[model samples]
Target: MVEITNMCRTTGCAIGDIKLYCAGFTSANLINPLIFRHLPTPNHDYCIVNNGNPLSAGAVLSFHYDNTFMYRDFSVSTVTCIS
Candidate 1:
């Protein structure tokens, strides 16, 4: 399992580029294999992850989601953990 500190070490990636990333926890073994794509929008506010591929752990995982437009700092609207 890659550490959270290791996953996405860089900052500010464009919406639709091939990003080299790493993930935290063994679960990433299951979620990091597939390619991720962010949809185009008027404001690069959020991205939709395609989930034709299914992901699961023995236990259900819940992600805390949030959105921000007030700050100019980088943010990702949504992310799909996949493998």
Candidate 2:
């Protein structure tokens, strides 16, 4: 199977526009779509993701995870094969 790398590339994205992105894993044939909204914020310190009340410019973006689904899996293991 072919491996996919460097996805969700944005092109000509203007400000104040909502964008959708899809992510996939190399070990499985699954794709997860995520939504991103660009709002007027001071910095990347605090921001809201998923579906929530849109905050105005200069307003603090609280971390509200009521309407979002974040999937992640990471682990480390050691294996040895006898020759």
Top model number, lDDT: 1
Q: Worst lDDT window (10 residues) for model 2?
A: 74-83
> Where does model 2 exceed 4 Å of error?
1-52, 62-83
> Per-residue lDDT of 1-83 in model 1, one digit per residue for the tens?
11111143234321222232212112222342333323344543443332223323232222322234222332433334443
Residue 68 deviation, candidate 2, in Å?
Answer: 20
Alpha carbon lDDT of residue 25, candidate 2? 15
For model 2, state the Cα shift of residue 67 in Å.
Answer: 20
Please, what is the whole-model Cα lDDT of each candidate in the order they appear?
Answer: 0.29, 0.25
Q: What residue runs in model 1 are displaced by over 4 Å at the alpha carbon? A: 1-34, 50-52, 58-83
CA displacement after TM-score superposition, residue 21 of candidate 1 (Å)? 17
How much lDDT does candidate 2 score?
0.25
TM-score of each prediction: 0.23, 0.18
Q: Compute the lDDT for candidate 1.
A: 0.29
Candidate 2 per-residue C-alpha lDDT over 1-83 given as tens digits, one digit per residue, 9 for 90 to 100 = 21212222343321222212223212222322222232234532221232332323333322222213442421112112211
Could you give me the TM-score of model 1 versus the true structure? 0.23
